[model samples]
Target chain A: MTPRRILLGAAGAVVVVGVLEAVSRSGLVDETSLPPASTVLKEAGKLAVDREFLVDVGATVREWLLGLLLAVLAAVPLGVLLGSVPLLGTASRALVELCRPVPSVALIPLATLLFSSPAQTNMSLIFYACLWPILVNTLYALRDVDPVAKDTLRAFGSSTPAVLWRVSLPSAAPFIATGVRIAASVALVVLISTELLVGGDNGIGIYLTETQQGGGRTDLMLAGACWAGVLGLLANTALIALERVAFRWHAARVEGIA
Target chain B: MLEISGLGHAYGTHRVLEGIDLKVGEGELVTIVGPSGCGKSTLLRCIAGLVPPTEGKVVLKGAPIDGVPDDLAVVFQDYSRSLLPWLTVRDNVALPLRRRGLGKAERRAQAVKALASVGLEDAAGKYPWQLSGGMQQRVSIARALAYKPTLMLMDEPFGSVDAQTREDLEDLVLQVHRAEGMTILLVTHDIDESVYLGDRVVVLARNPGRVRDELPVTLPAGRDQIGTRADAEFVRLRAEVGRLVRGVVKDSEPPDATDAEDADAEAVATAVEEPAKK
Candidate 1:
């Protein structure tokens, strides 16, 4: 990002905060119902050092990471298998279409009953939610691999697996990285949603629920959500940085085309 | 050695090639020239064992072609797409060497040697996308050379480059052909390229493409673009091939001025129309 763009973004944020603060101070809504931006920002800052809130953040981040890792481990191979083998892709097309659209949140009650631990429940939901984006991206990326590149390897007498390793996998990697970034965001959302709905012992979602119970503290609830947004922003920025470093060749070629 | 007889192919109901018969001795460089839609590439693909012939068979070294042979390589027209962008030039060349049961170090050494042969050793550490179009094509050629295949197929290998680069690449092919002494079957639509680069030119006619004529190039082995292309024999052969390619000589009738025996040395050297300059 350029300095001017960053300055513009910060300016936009300041305007938003100013507008929210003005609306709250003018009594457009009761303070109890809609906390001022300054009060929420203050609570959010204090929660950064609060030990109890730190534990909740740790719980949420841990679940999100582990679930996302598992999804990557499972879904990438599955996508490659299906993408490389047309017969398998055709055989499973209907099944994939059937399962992909069912919302993971709708499975919360079933997951709570199935898993003995709340952590397991949260992880399963997050894993399910994160799987599709990574899998679909991998599938399409493999489809988009240059046919001439594959044929060049084949004409050199390279076997199928070698072609996959040397050509298709590397060609698909940038798209797969994109999928992982999307999945990271999805995983965090699912983790928080599960914790809120299932009432986990320690999580950002659980803390928000407790704030609601304790006299409906709008400031604390908003602060907890603000931290969630910051976590997502941090994760996205880190993943983008990783992609830029790892897929520099992809970036250069894309720039050349543009 | 390679032998193809009665080879034909069709996509569904659209027949692209039919009743083709050709042979190439070991260490021979043969080029196939045809007009567009003549299935020249399809013929190469059949010989490469990538697209199985719908009619007949290809036999290489006494073994019938099945899948892609164990000792074969192809340089495609679209070099940018043929070379992997993710790998550096050296690694792209080295990747095919793994099929030869070579270790990583051996592969790297062989890849570097091949790149050096193409005068691209300095580009070995750079990604394919980092190089210019001609350099990328050289990388693809280097990849093919690194494999040390018994048979190399090229489908319009220089079709994408500019005229200057194309001439340079043609000389490079001649140099490598002399050094390697491997069998090569190249397909192209450029009639001049066919006569300039081939030991023998096989011309094909379109509409269910089939072989129309084969002319042995009598040009000297050590050829330069300017001197060889301007030679009298080169001019005569090019005109004849152009006429054959354009269907000027009817399929049933033969040109009366030329005979098959001692034709290169004593064919009608005079009264031949010069081919239009490019």
Candidate 2:
């Protein structure tokens, strides 16, 4: 955007921080419970270099990336199968509808019982949460591919697989990228939430749980959450940049459609 | 090199095309003109193996064509839909070459040459959407030309462009046909277009589409819009084809109109249209 817009955006953040600091410091809220904004900011800064916190960050990033990658692997092919084969999609519709909306967090009991390890449990939870967006996006994108383009390829004697590979896949790629970007956020949420609730062996979520349980360090809990939010923002920005660079024409087309 | 005999197609219980029998010898440019619902596009689809006929079959070069033949290319009317928007103009042209097992360099080189042929050399790097309607259709033509297909099927390929662009595209096809002698079958509803492009024009009637008449165009080759269209032969042939497509004729009108009117009605029940033999 414009430099003025960027300056205003930064000013907006400052105003928000200024208001919170005022409220927290004026004794409007008890410092023992709220822990002034400055205290939280100081904890967040210190946690940036804290090796334990760094490890926690690394663990969460690893789980988020791994879970997202696994979801892509499972969902893309399934989407293609269901998207390309009408009969297969019709057959799977009932099962997909039944399973898609059930909150993934509710599956923790089943995952813990089935998987005997916490890492597996975290992976399963994130995987379940990330799968729907990627799969559904892929299915719809493939469906949205231009039929005439596919027919043109076929008229040149390209087989069904060739048409899919050459036309349908590339056409659906931008949508797939969007799905991945969305899933990156979803995976992070599920990862951190599962770690918090289940108290995994070592994770940002578990670390946040430790901060609260070990004498209630609310600042550390908030700081850790702040770091998680930063990571999610950074991941999404990178994925969006990747999508722009790789699919410029698609981006233009999407904007036109929008 | 292409033969369609007793070809009929019905989508569900609704028959769209029936008894469509025509043949194009090697190097012949045959155009089909018909009313809007005459299933002209469906006929092209059947010939290209995009759709199969329910009645008779399409035999290309002595083989019963059940699927899209390896040496055929199609230029659809909707260039926005036909040309892959994600690909640059050059890449879209080169895409059909992938199945031919060409290397990257060769495909690019051939694609560039094809783009040059279609007068789109400078547009190679641009996306199809960045260009005007005419240029987008040119990219579609370039894609078809790059394939080096033995037979080309164009379904109202210039229908979306402006009149000037349409005429230019028509001339480009003629120039390409003269240069490569590629057997071509073009379907259009524009009566003048059929008369101008084809060595022979096949006209189809609507309501379970069937061939109405086949008129051999006798205008001399090396045609241009100025000299060729003004020729008396060209006017006669255009009106004859117009009569066929518009379904307006009267044997009592005049000597010129009567000749064309007499050619219709009984255009049915005729299988082998030996215009040369007649």
Candidate 3:
């Protein structure tokens, strides 16, 4: 990003904060329901070092990572298999279309009944939420592989498996990484939602629940939300950095086109 | 040696090629020239074992072809799409060598040597996209050369480049063909290209694509883009092939004359004999 863009973004954030601060302190909203922006920021800063809060953050991150990893491990191969084999892809189309659109949050009630522990319930919901993006991205990426490249390898006497390994997989990898990055953010959202709804043993969502139940602390609730937003931002930034480093050729091609 | 007889192909009910019979002796260069939609590419694909003909068979050295043969390579018309962009030039040239059961170092060494032959050794470490269109086509040719195939098929290989680059690539093909002494069958719609590069030019008719005629190229084996193309024999053969491709009657022959195929074949044969008789 350019320094000018960074400066503009910071200015936008400050303006938003200033508006929130004014609206809260001017009695436009009830003090108990809407904490001042300064109070929320202070509380968020304190929570950054709060040991109990840190534990909840760690638990949420761990669950998000685990669920996203499982989804990628399961989805990439399944996507490749479906993409390479036309008959199998056609056979599974009905089932995939049916499952892909149902929101994972709506499955929280079923997950709770199916799994014995809170962690299990959250993990299953996270996996379900993260599966489709990675799968669909991989499928489209494989379809988009350069047909001539595949034919060239085949004409050189390369086997089907060799063609897929040498050409299809590498061509699809950048898209698959993009899919995983998208799934990572989705996993975090679902993990926190499940934790809040199911009251997981230790998580940011569970901590937010504690603040609501203990004294209805508006500052603490907003601070918890701020952390969730921060975590998402951090994860996305890290994954984008990784993509740049790993797929320099893809990036160069994209830049050339643009 | 390679032999194809009574070969025919159809995509579902739409017929693409019909009754194609051709032979390529060892160490010979044959060029197939035709108009668009003549299924020249399909015929090449059939011989490469990529597409199965609906009728007849392709025999290579006494064996009926079932799948892509190990001792064959193809230089496609589209160099940009044919070469993998992710790999460096050296890697792309070496990729097919894995089938030869060579180790990494040997593959790299051979790839470098092939690049040098194509005069692209300095660009070995660069990606395919980093090079110009002409340079990329050279890399693809180098890749095919490194494979050391017994039979090499080129499908309109220089159809994309500018005229100057096209000449350079044509000479590169001749250089490699002469140096390696491999059987080469090149297909193109350009009548001049066919006469310029081939030891023999096989012309195909468009509708239900079939072989129209085969004219043996009598030009000197040592050819240059400038000297060879300006030769009298080259001019005569090109015009002859051009007329055959456009399915036009010779200026000396009447337009209303029937039996166009027999008349054209007989006239071309007579024209081919007159020079040798002198």
First chain TM-score for all predictions? 0.98, 0.96, 0.97
How does residue B46 of candidate 3 score in lDDT? 94
Per-residue alpha-carbon lDDT of candidate 3 for residues A1-258, written as tens digits (9 for 90 to 100): 899999999999999999999999999999889999999999999999999999999999988998888899999999999988989888988888899999999999999999999888888898999899999899889989987799899999999999999999999999999999999988988888888888967999999999998568989999999999999999999999999998988998888779
Clashing pairs in 1: none
Ordering by lDDT: 3, 1, 2
For model 2, residues B132-204, the per-residue Cα lDDT tens digits are 9999999998999999999999988887777788889999999999999999999876778888999999998
lDDT winner, 1 or 2 = 1
lDDT digits (tens) for residues A1-258 of candidate 2: 589999999999889878888888999998767777788889999999999989888888888888889999999999999999999988988888888898889998899898887888889888898899999999999999988889888898888998999999999999988988998998888888889887766889989889978579887888888899999889988998898899988878778779
Which ranges of candidate 1 are over 4 A from the true structure?
A: B248-278
Worst 10 residues of 3 chain A by lDDT: A192-201
**Deviation (Å) of B238 in candidate 3:** 1.3
Residue B215 of model 1: what lDDT?
Answer: 97
Q: Rank the candidates by DockQ, best first.
A: 1, 2, 3
DockQ of every predicted complex: 0.68, 0.59, 0.58
lDDT of each residue in B125-157, candidate 1, tens digit only: 999998988999999888899899899899888
Specify the poorest-scoring 10-residue window by lDDT in model 1 chain B: B265-274
